[model samples]
Target: MASRTTSWAYRPSLDGLRMLAMYLIILFHTQVPWIQGSFIAVNLFFVLSGYLVTNVVLTEMERTGRLDLGRFYARRVRRLLPAALVAIVGISLVFLLVAPVVRRLGLVGDAQGSLLYVANWRFIAQANDYFAPNVDKSPFLHFWTLSIEEQFYVVFPLLILLLARSSRRGVMVAGLAVVTVASIGAQVYWATADPIHAYYGTDARLYQLSAGALMAVALRTWPVRLPRVGARAVAVGGMALFAVLCFSAVAMSQSNRGFLGTAACLMIVAGLMLDEDQPLAKALSLRPVVYLGQISYSTYLWHWPAILVMGMFLDVGPVTMAALAAVIATGLAAASAELLEQPVRSAKRLNRFRWRVSAVGVACSVLAAVLVVPTVLEREQPPAVASGTGGAAVGKLAAAHSDPLPKDVDWDRVDRDRGTEQTCQVDDLDRCVLHEGSGAHVLLVGDSHARMMTAMFEQLAKKHDFTLSTNIVSGCPWQENLRNTQSSPKRQERCDEARTGWYDTVLPRLDPDLVVVATLPRDHGKWHQRLENRDGSDLGLERSLLRATRDTLDKIEKVADRTLMVQSVATPRSFVPNDCLTSAKDPDDCVVPLTTTNRPSDAYYLAVAADVDAAYTVDLNPAFCPAGPLCSPVVDGMVVWRDNQHLTASFVAHQRAKVWRLIQQTGVLDALDGL
Candidate 1:
């Protein structure tokens, strides 16, 4: 039972494979729009790493007669830790200082968890919810991959050592094969069950690494010595195949995962096993490609954040055209490698004291991350709560220090009270707040849609010495529950809880002077939105809106005072208001000009307004949606909306003239305004 090292097995072909894998990585991240399947490069690396590391460890144990556990771990620490620490610290700082509310985005989960490599698990928990995917602000989201690799290295070496005790070669080979097979199976099962978590899961990815380890063992025992002609062909064929695999892997849609990934990795390994003396080998081993391979770690670390910052913050064009960005990023990464990575990697230890100090620095980072995330969460407003099941609450609540609502909500206490109900149900928005002041008592109420009008309400309140209040809650239908109680699961439960809570907790508490309710009613979901109409066209949108309007009027009658001021449904715009405004020739002409000859129609809101006006006698729609088919997103040099759908803060603030006058006409805020 001799180790592979004891029995003549060292191959530069593997380095050739590493070269190919890294090249794929470069192309994948480059996302050179033409290179569709570049992502498959990661799979290739996984396979190659699995095979090579396994081979090395098994071979070492068989030949040396004993495993140096401490040295093995120390080597791993030396190879991975310093670079990782530098990257994490550097990225975390960027997020903390440069990015707005970056720490609030959940950069590090509970502090200690991120430092200990359990950030993966924390991500798993968060990612399960639809809203949780982008929750974290950490620039180190990519570190989960490294964490998985490091975790595998830690355990796999120990497993190989144990298996090597009995006929080292036989057990080592068998154990690796068994693990590889099991890992592949797990991948297939979990990928289907929970693709998001499974994709990031270490267990599902182990087989790819094992493939490389197995290759290491096989080459050690077999010794691939090809004739010049044969060697050249193998090498060339492997290289070509590797390139094909890379292209193929990246080109495929993210949906097709299992078979393609396995096949791609296999191709990379075959290429790596080719002859060292072959032309392909000589080319790959050249100083440039080899140097890139050496510094690839830094390249991978910095490339993504560079792209993210450019795309998200700077509003860079499509990722396909991010070449200049990539270039700048690459130069910086290379410089970091030379200045930071190489120094730490090649340095001789000064003393045990220095090592201890470095360890403490690492610990401090985790502590800081933990403390920062919660603080950020506390500062933002929470989402409104739609009515739901009896015992369960729908939205996440912000604790004492963190505001669930934004600061602008505070201009009117009435809005804050309405926001409280909304926040109780949905955790997605900021709760409205009211500042300490002397003013008219104006109340705003409805669903999440009404929350957008806060700026307008606050402006009107300030100008007229009126206090503003809101009755908006998030997620819950301000109109009515469109889903049938018997059919819908989440909606049914939510509606019931909201109904009960509104009647019990909210209704009796706030008897404000005036109420303004806004709602966008619609029936949306799998079957409802897809059903056909009388003329064989889709009438789902129209029907859904109509139903929603009816439900809204019903709810408004229950809570609103004698004179309810209802805003007319404004024409929906599809792009951000400012982007459109900025693109226009003159900022004053901030309107989305209409192409269709017909007047803009919103069936549900119009219907609800018609019914409510007839019953309670108030018309606020003309102030907002007055006149022609064209809807001016910005009126009289003022922007009305921040985004495509909802009213912007600026728009809300400027609505003072129209909104206050409407309230005066209706006599809704007379009591609070001292009229």
Candidate 2:
């Protein structure tokens, strides 16, 4: 029952493993093909942290008869917090000076979260998709992994103390095993619907860390039972398979992440059990490789911010960026470890004053947060919903050709803010805000395309004395038994769930005078975008669109007095309009012809609208796009879109006066008048 009291040995090979994992992280961030899909590198980080911390705690207890938690925390703080805070403070300063406010929109909050070891949960709260293509990724995004490990450090020590009555090795192993199994189960359940949550959550990722914890308890003596051949085979083959997964689409998925975590654990075991003579072990033990591992902690901290900062100045390909970021981060990490990290880590005076070190850690975190206050205080234009009596100001604008880009505009708001309907995802289908104060009710439904219409609806609702609410999501639209093909299989499950939720749960809650369906229609998903019923077969693109539209309308008609469908605006062939206008000498240069290539076919959407009786449709494109070959992004002195497809909420608000006229022209509101 006695736990072994072996001295902790420095394993160069494990450090080598650390180096390799760090490389994978750098490569993934740099958008290396195939590698970007993998989560193995992140799993390996959790395993290493769990294994080493468990070893240190158990070793201390076995040798001293009691765990000194204060000392342990002081050590952890010195090891992690110093370099992390420096990176947070230093990188944030760079962002303040170099990056525009649009790029630095959420950096203040992100830096604070990163400092306090809560960035992981913060991301989960924000519904951040780690894999989503964000043009303005937070510099502190990498800090989420560090936060998870820090959480384990704080909790694991207390857990051991709770189990102090039983010091048996088997008991310790069993305790960790139970947690590992439960963590894996939690991951499976969460991964089914919200993979982003599953990916970043401490509870879901606990098993990966526990894998190493189990290894630490069961194999503390560093003894190898396997022969050279078996060790070589297991180590080489497991790593090879792991590498293959990292390079394949299969490895990119969060649900499949367990396999990668297991593979990492197997590799760690092989590294320990294999003798120094083994090829994997010997190669990993080399001084140069081990040096990278030695500086790996600081390197991980520096990598992402360095990439983003360097990206501002360097116009390079992915490979070049990856190489540049790696070199810069490694160099900086190496120097920081030598000059700053190691000095603080080994300071005998600081180690002696445990309470003081903890105090210093807390103070540093607060200081880092305070550093960004100036930027946060800077006044910027309000996002989404406007700030005045009329709403986001639709001031008289000059001609579209000569009007320069508005300096006062907040690009972050345009890109990020989607009003409060953001909460009413399919997962929470009944979450839409009901404006009970107003006598008449209006509903907006569809995808992000529909979300952009919020401001216009708000305007109409205010003027017409009606209440407006939206049931919209970015990639989800109202469809029966459907999925978004652009979305992953797991996302498809959520999409389908959302469809059922909105129709079966949300629709029946409140009767609305009118329902507006606005979506960018395209042929995608399971069952040809689920055009047919559950029992029916695929009906091609056109027939399928008709069937889907009919199904959606049928549901709306059940509760809504009238239904109004929208034909989405024209898509420009040029780059993101806001970005284009930023550099274009003339605002008109941002305009591009609505070519067949960039323009999506909404023929099915229009046909469905026309065919459905008692269901009116609106085409607001003519108000914005002139009857010509060119599609202007600037309309009525406001930038029409935040990006390629979604209209800016502010722009929509500004155009509300014109939009109301268009709605009046459609006679959809005339029916509202009759009501």
- Per-residue lDDT tens digits for candidate 1, residues 3-106, read 11223355554554555555455455434545546555667667766766665665577679777665565555655665665665565555443342312234
Model 2, residue 19: C-alpha shift (Å):
0.8
Residue 340 local lDDT, model 2? 93
lDDT of 2 by residue, 1-675 (tens): 212223467678889988988988898898776676455688877888888888788788889999998899989899899898888878866655554343344456777889889998887876655653323367888999999999999899998777666856677778888999899898988898777779889999889888888877777634446666666676787777777767746634656755565765567555455545577888888999999988999999999988876754454677899899899999989989999999998788786799778888878787767655445422232222211112111111212343456667766766775544443543453456534335577778777778777767776666667877777766776656444566666856656655765665667765667887777656433434433444355655544455667777788778887777776565652357778777766666665444321111243443344334456666676455552234565666666777776667766777677766767665566646432
lDDT of 2: 0.68
Clashing pairs in 2: 37-252, 386-392
Positional deviation of residue 48's Cα in model 1 after best superposition, in angstroms: 3.2
**Where is model 2 more than 4 Å wrong at Cα?**
1-7, 102-105, 221-224, 249-252, 370-675
Clashes within 3 Å, all models in order: 65, 2
